[model samples]
Target chain A: MLHAPASPQADLQSEPNDFSAILAEQTDRLLAQHVTPACLKAADGGVFPAAAWEAVSDAWLPLALVPEAAGGVGLDAPAAAQILRRSGYHALPAPLAETMLGLALWSAAGGAAVEGPVSLATGLLRLASGTILAEGTMAHVPWAGAAGHVLAIAEAPDGARHLALLPRAAYTIVPRRNLANEPRETLHIGTAPLGPDALLPLPAPLAGPDGLMLFGAFARAQQMAGAMERCLDLAVAYANERKQFGKPIGRFQAVQQMLAVAAGESAAAGAAAQVAAAAWNTDQFPLAVAIAKARCGEAAGKVAEICHQVHGAMGFTQEHVLHFITRRLWAWRDECGNDAHWQERIGRMVCAQGGAALWPRLVALRAAANGDRGTQP
Target chain B: MPDMRFATVAFPKDAEDLRLQVRRFLEAEKADGRFVPHRSSWNTFDPDFSRRAAKAGYVGLTLPEAYGGHARSSLARFVATEEMLAAGAPCGAHWIADRQSAPQILRHGTQVARDHIIPRICAGECYFGIGMSEPDSGSDLAAVRSKAVRGAGGWVLNGQKIWTTNAHRVHYLLALVRTGDAGADRHGGLTQFIIDMAAPGISVRPIHDLSGNHEFNEVFFTDHFVADDFVVGEVGDGWSMVTQELAFERSGPDRFMSDYRLLTELVDRIGPAPDARQAVETGRLVAHMGALMAMSGSVAALLDRDIVPNVEAALVKDVGTAFERDIPEVARRLVAVEASLDAQDDRFAEALADVALRAPSFTLRGGTREILRGVIARGLGLR
Candidate 1:
């Protein structure tokens, strides 16, 4: 009954261009057991509960050390992402995501970091000589401060790409600061030694320009979801409490319908995210991820702003939770490959895919938006 | 499951592998000719197919295993539904029962209704219909004029329900009768009764649609008696309960896949040697379908989480119907043919014709486009 999982011959990879179900199943398990009933407030380290991270680890999520023959889950990039999307829905925090990304980088370089805690720098904007001066600033990561070891993906001195791992003890940490007031920190790594324990083997670029675009798109989309939920909660509570012109605002059709549209935007955003996730998980198509992320980020921002309008003056208050939520939305929208970035990427793809055939592909992508992937009529 | 509300999760991708198992089961029926594709997946009648599907454990899909359901996830059902509609499996006998009646009964009907009706529904023999929509009552459902007066046996109902799909065939009708008048806030005082179609004083007349085939009916109930035990939920909770049922009806794959026949034709017509235009057009539609699948899957995930997700559900249904309608329009633009009445042997051509006729009413049914847009707008805070 107990046999080793069959090994995939690299040449045969295209023989079955599918990994969605596996990804979906693994993600299903992670969501079912690993994540907590509550989220990590940005102040509570801007990370998921320790229990949640452990739960994800229990599901072997961090083991997405793809190159490791004996490492954790033994999944590829696509499989790893499916779980990330699941973690996202449950708001699993960034620690787990960082770890998977780190392990992947390390595995590429023939190193084994999966056995211990590791972190990965995302949305890396390369400065001259890999001494990265980036907006992400090390801490404001979705779950950065808690991860054991941090890896910054940057361009090396040789003008080639290298994933540099910054040890937890290597740099001086700055106080957490963010719009959402979620847990985030900045590190001053003034020419610190790029230690051997932190390095991975790969010489070529681990993740491409398209990866950054899609990654941001996906994260922005998820953050939109978190914000949309926030919107619904704010509107519902306001409708129940705030009486305007002598009646509960909810009783009014105008108000009711406004709240409803916010809900729809949430659905639409979520729809984009799911399609991106499934496509990325199964086919690793950068274009689908780019489009999904673009739609989700732009739409989410719109949804968040409208929801605030629906909430009126009360939503603007610092005392209310909305200030915190909407602030996160504002920042997150720009964090993962912003709208402009993805649009450019999609534009490039469309141009390259050819104008004659591009329009249909866009339509196909739109049809593909809901995760349909031609499963049925 | 990761919450669909917070995540974009596609259904077919998540559930298709399992859905394939369910598909094989239903496909077996098709191969045996025991079931043909249902014209209207929800309202079409075929008792034999219903029994076979029931035997296959498709009905009462969400019920507890002890109650005979498979205890499947809502996404699984979503996959099964789209697949059935795609194949046109005639599941009318248990469609209503499985879709709304049994679920409502399970949640609010007497233990008698749950124990007796649910198992039979899962078994695929008993059927149910919605006793909503009167002659004048169009979309504003609260204005229903059907009255139910308490009688010695239980309750006596007198009302006429229009668009009572499969009324003549189903074993029961979930009649929304006014137990008393609670004016202005008209949602109150209405009670749901499991009216036996075979009972005395019930007359059902078939209504032909644009296709010249009989599907829906006008059902008249004159002093039709129902037991007090048949009352669903608390009296006056009918409005909230019925509103809740819309979440079930509108969110599934049925919304957009109605004209899938056209999609297949477009694909088949393209063949392997497609020109650049055909490939692009076909790919675009296919991709849109993928996105839609993800959205619907998220809703199914929502159901798994026990969140009502009413607004999100409404979005999928609205978008889905729009997409379903668009398939034919897109196909028409892509293909060349004389648009005519009556379906030819070509499934795509027939489907395109059918969709052209039925697409107008797609949004009108369950809830109108205007009403659904209002719901979406309200959900988005734009209204």
Candidate 2:
């Protein structure tokens, strides 16, 4: 199965000013105004929620993959990741990750625009016969329970990349518990996957040595960032409310120090993730992605432990959401190419080249991703 | 701190071709075996050779032309340092002075100090050392007990300084002294002086590190006399001055390029197209260095713009040291080369063994990792 290279990005343009900040801010507004209020009302309309997706889709959140010409907001990678992370933070039990992942595949296929109640899954998918063959069941699929359109990626037997798009009704929603109590489910699609035309003949499924690791890392790092944020909020709330020695626990030095470290973990992780996502948005993929993954992976546990300690006995209790946050941190820490894995990868890349060879390597990666392999710098 | 700022980073858009020019110069130096490739390129002393280097307009490349300096951008100076370091040039005599002292003098020192010292430094003659940390203070810089009280003649100093690298050999010391008693807050009232090392009240004694290298020294000043004009910056501002110098100290190729020689050797020994594991190991390290270099280069550009990105600089130094220390470990793991403290092989092995033994100090020397994290934590609005 020879995968065709993705097209040279022709629609690479500057997004509107404050697009990311606006979208991030909208996560709260939409989550509170639309997502939460909407989801709590429609839990009986099947396990997968089309109502929520349709609402978000109408709001231009679903067409994140669409270019400016296609009547979409034309959000880039970083902006999308930011929205997804906030989605995680708000625990808006919706299939946003799925929609974005599918739209990503659709965008790669030169589709008109991405839309509908969508969801995304990360693992391996393959195309087989007339059916879009799917393999590699995705673990920790966010919003899997509420997705209307699920995009599952698999490598075909012929080596061509395939994207399987199943409607909300098609998936067997085997409910699963995620670290955070966000909606998750096991997606089992038959060999007769989705429609062939729906299985867009996309280029390589971004499963290369570094790209896959990076994308995976970015997603996990985003989730970890959300957990870190939640932890900080949890700790701050606990510190303010829990009193000891006739004062709030936050007044104590030891509590403050631990809280400080957790805050640091969040900042470093967020900084690294943002930088990486920003790089990806600008098409500087591998190096930025690797750095983000490494830093975020290291920060995940650090924030979790500090935060858990800050919560003390309450955190360990299921009644509180602290365990939920730490659990996500634990899961997401190893979700991408773990810290050790990416560190070794980065280390080896650095050692192999001359101190000054980074320029050529970057130029080469861009060219390759742009399907201009023979273009020498 | 969270402003939308842009750092141009240190890429001379059209000046990459100039690398060839520098490489040619280094090659010429290497041809006749004029370059020895010492273990400590910048720290290794070679006064005559350094004078030759300055004569080539390589030293003081960033200072103002009015002061006999080359008036080049920091990138150009960076180019010169990168080349010198890559070639293992013994730039000890003028390295610190060129990198730190001249800049301080040009920016903050008295006109007399700049006139007397700048041209000579540009010509690779006079040198200076940081006299910040005391014997008890260490990285707890605010704890500096080296006090200088105002006297009629100028000032009288009685204090002991430690870890003053190349201080014994340098012409002057930029010692931070308490000009007045500071209560509660340990950093108050400290002043920086361009202390002439040859003054009668000063005694410099070399203290070899655990590596048996006469790298640093302890200097005791008993009633050391200095003119009021000798102060580097305003009175009671030594802490800020030292903090600013740190942005200079921490953000440089020096942070990561310390053991780069060993890294290169490891790769050279690895040969072309390494096995899967080796490729993975070496590839990742090299990639990280690339990103680290880019980040550090960004900070350099930030410094060039006169916007002291202290937090960004701290990030660079912290991440840079972690990568540096990991280099030797990765290299050793890749190829189980015979490495030990007692080795006396080619200078390659000697340097590797030396760097391996000394790598622990990489994090410790430039503020410990713990402190760096604390700094970063604070910078991130976490503390």
DockQ of each: 0.11, 0.17
Candidate 1 per-residue lDDT, tens place, A116-229, comes to: 356444535343444433332444444445666666665555656555666665555676655555445666555555555554443334466643334444545654654556
Best by TM-score: 2
lDDT of 1 by residue, B20-135 (tens): 66668876877887753423444457888778777776676787777788787777776677667666677667877888788788888888778878787888878888887889
Give fnat of each prediction, in order.
0.17, 0.16
lDDT of 2 at B183: 57
lDDT of 2 at B297: 58
Mark the regions of model 1 whose C-alpha exceeds 4 Å error after superposition.
Answer: A1-263, A274-291, A294-377, B1-18, B32-43, B64-76, B272-284, B340-345, B373-383
TM-score of 1: 0.62
Overall local distance difference test of candidate 2:
0.65
